[model samples]
Target: MRQYWVAPVGPFHTADGTAYATSITLTDVSPAPQITLPANMLEIGSEIELEASGFFSNTATPTLLLGFYLGGVAGVALAASTAVTTTTAAVAWPFQLRYRGVVRSIGAAGSIVGQGRLYLPTSLVASTTRFIPETAALRTVAIDTTVAKTVTVGAQWGTSSASNTLTCQDLSVRLVT
Candidate 1:
């Protein structure tokens, strides 16, 4: 069996006095319905995007691990937030992780903000962007159909402050093969 999944498309405009509609076809082999793989297993030479968002706030900030895992025992780790600290305040954190390669090249980024002391004892603000270099030797581990795997994208609140609120807005995996 095969399936063609078309995602939502709209708001496409032609402002140059010329407009055109284009379509691309994607093919996929049918797999178990209960465990749906957006495009399928993480094949070699494939690119995948893992997106996730969440909200967090704390009165007595604590350490947090917001990341995504792509395997079981041996796998790739796409971290959106690593050892992020929550202060005595409320803030929303959203993140995205990307993996592309024959051997996988992984990267991650997100919105980070805080009031007063956070992450560090001193005030600091920096962007978080990481990418693995693409090379001939690059390789990404695949999900073994026979064994269990842990491919999850989410945030883990280590401890609670006065009001520690952790909410996951969205989590999705898209394949760009």
Candidate 2:
């Protein structure tokens, strides 16, 4: 059994080319795309960002749902009240993850099997709701790496059952670093 997952896009390099990120291709067709990387499990002194895109068949609208811990984490299936549409989108939550080895087993686990990390260990559930009406590909997630230890990032397009999901190459190379 080979470890492999199918994504529309790629796990590319970041701006500094140091860290990496990935995205799920958004199209007019497909299942609703949903992704999450729990909270409170990142190694100290780590800088990272997550990006998600849903392939919309038609340009009706996009919805944003976030869930995690620390300061700005929310639920996965975000409130119906909160929805958005764009080419690309990103969310920044200050967090630290604890499970390094576990989270990096997505590919090996195969497809349709969700994977995650813990950014907030002890208590607390999530944070706020900051939505962008429009999102572009290139520059999605932005974090300083000083505030958060770990974070969960994901998105869903109003149109799509399966939006392709990918991560930065650096991250793909090593799900947990």
Candidate 3:
């Protein structure tokens, strides 16, 4: 039998008028939301899913980076998307990012393999959304499942400008066993 668990982290939404121009560990509400994976919480075939939505505006086209971390924004990287260059400037574009990973092993040598994708709007006037696929080859990450782990997501902008801002509107994490 399979069981599912929703991490008590978020549906975190950023407050209006709050945006970040530099790389940041995203937090809109008080205290950034994080998923706590307890020791031995994962077994072989266990899976995790992370989803987020946000808006971005740029003065000039800049490369955007999104990543998943084990502890916090500065922690060990589990997976990251390749830098994606924006196509438009001075326009508020909405984006959705999602990642799914499955545990391949457990114990001290526990590992998971995952991939992520980003959905970005090419134009506000047009009904087209650009699909930015994660370019990194899927690989196993060594995570010690015998100890508790914290997970977080972060965003970075290649160029810093007042007009170049990003805000995470929502984020959620889930686990399946």
| Candidate topping lDDT | 3
**Model 3, 1-177: lDDT tens per residue?**
855665544434334324677543342211244456788888888888877676778866777776666666655557666566876574767777777788999998778888766676666644233332344443467788898877765777777667778776666677876
**RMSD (Cα, Å) of candidate 1?**
15.2
- lDDT score for residue 113 of model 2: 15
Better of 1 and 3 by lDDT: 3
The candidate with the higher TM-score, 1 or 3, is: 3
Q: How far out, in Å, is residue 29 in model 2?
A: 13
lDDT of 1 by residue, 26-75 (tens): 11111111112322343434444544443444556666554445441124
Residue pairs in clash, model 3: none
Runs in model 1 deviating more than 4 A are: 1-40, 71-76, 91-150
Error of 1 at 90 (Å): 1.0
lDDT of 2 by residue, 50-146 (tens): 3332211222233432222212233221111134333333232232212111221122121111223323111133423333212222112322222
User: Residue 48: error of model 2 in Å?
Assistant: 2.5
Error of 1 at 151 (Å): 3.7
